[model samples]
Target: MAKHLDLEEQEQLDEIKHFWKQYGNAITWVLIAVLGAYAAWNGYQYWQRSQASQAAAMYDEVEKVSREGDADKLQRAFDDMKSRFASTAYAPQAGLLVAKTLYESGKVDGAKAALTWVAEKSADAGYASVGRLRLAGLLMDSKAYDEALKVLDTGMTEEFAALQADRRGDILLAQGKKPEAKEQYLKAFKAFDDRTDYRRLVMVKLNSLGVDPLADAAAPVAADKGAASK
Candidate 1:
């Protein structure tokens, strides 16, 4: 019986050795692949955090130079931020700050350049819309009416719809396109909420164009009702 038990133990040992010989390399490779992936993910997360930290530091420098009203320093700092961290939110925010400072310092061309960069390259859609709107205003001021219209033609987020329409109306009026201006103003009027002071301003613009927005709306409904009765 003892000899039989020894033979049984040796058989089990032989089976274990056979299993390891068949699958050992594949199991080892699977473990290594999983660990390597985990390590790579951790490395990527660390790199992203490091990038954000560095970008935040540079953005602080931009805000400081802007507040000092130093155009050259502001420009240099903004250039550095854009070069190194354009993917970060802080880069576009710095662009806006630098543009404002440049404009205040009588650097119209510099301001426009910075605004154009933001409009063209910002990662955030909202920032891009703001950049386009401000750049359009500057273009209008320069009497680049066609260029301004082209900038406004770039689509904006829903929140800026009313403001963009109003801006378009202003440009059309400048171009002496009174009928088109009134049409855009009406669109602005409808887009704005009733409680907003901006809506009242839009009404004033409509009135200037000899169209009362409220009356125009009612006239359409009245015409529809009359047609139905007939």
Candidate 2:
């Protein structure tokens, strides 16, 4: 019985050896690939985190210089960050800040150039929208009415609808289209929440056009009641 048990054990050992000889290299390679992929994924995540952290620090630097309103320092830092980390979210945000600084410093053309870059190159839609909106405002200030309208015609989000309408109304008013301007003001007024002081401002615009939108809305009802009385 002892001999038989030894023979059985030896046979099992030989079978295991044969199995290892056949699949050992393949199993080793599979484990290597899996571990290599996991390591690479971890490395990539760490690299992205490091890059974003660096970009965030650069953005803070931009903000500090921007607050000082030093155009030269602001431009230098903006150029550095834009060149080094253009793909980061902080880049476009920094661009907007720098553009605003330039605008406040009476650098109109420089501000427009910065805003155009952000409008065209920003990866984030919200930043891009802000760039377009600001550019439109500037163009309107310059009396570049067609360009301003073009900027606004490019699909604004719901949050921007009222501002867009307000701008459009201003452009139309400038062009001597009182009826169209009144329509835009009405849209803006209705689109805005009551709490927005902008709504009262829109009301002022409507009054200027001699078309009280609320009165126009109630006129039909008043006419219906008059007909019923007749």
How many clashes in each structure?
Answer: 0, 0
Write one digit per residue (lDDT tens) for candidate 1, span 97-182.
Answer: 88888988899999999999989999988998899889998889899999999998875788899989999998999999999998
lDDT per residue (tens digit) for residues 1-230 in model 2 = 99999999999999999999999999999999999999999999999899899999999999999999888888899889988888889988998888899999999888888888788788777788788888888998899989988988874667888988998999888878888888889999889997999888999989987878788878999999999999
Give the C-alpha lDDT of model 2: 0.88
Indicate the TM-score of model 1: 0.85
User: Which stretches of candidate 2 lie above 4 Å from their native place?
Assistant: 1-37, 217-230
On a 0 to 1 TM-score scale, where does candidate 2 land against the true structure? 0.78
TM-scores for candidates 1 onward, in order: 0.85, 0.78
RMSD of each: 2.7, 3.7
Best by TM-score: 1
Residue clash pairs of candidate 1: none
Against the reference, the lDDT scores of all candidates come to: 0.91, 0.88
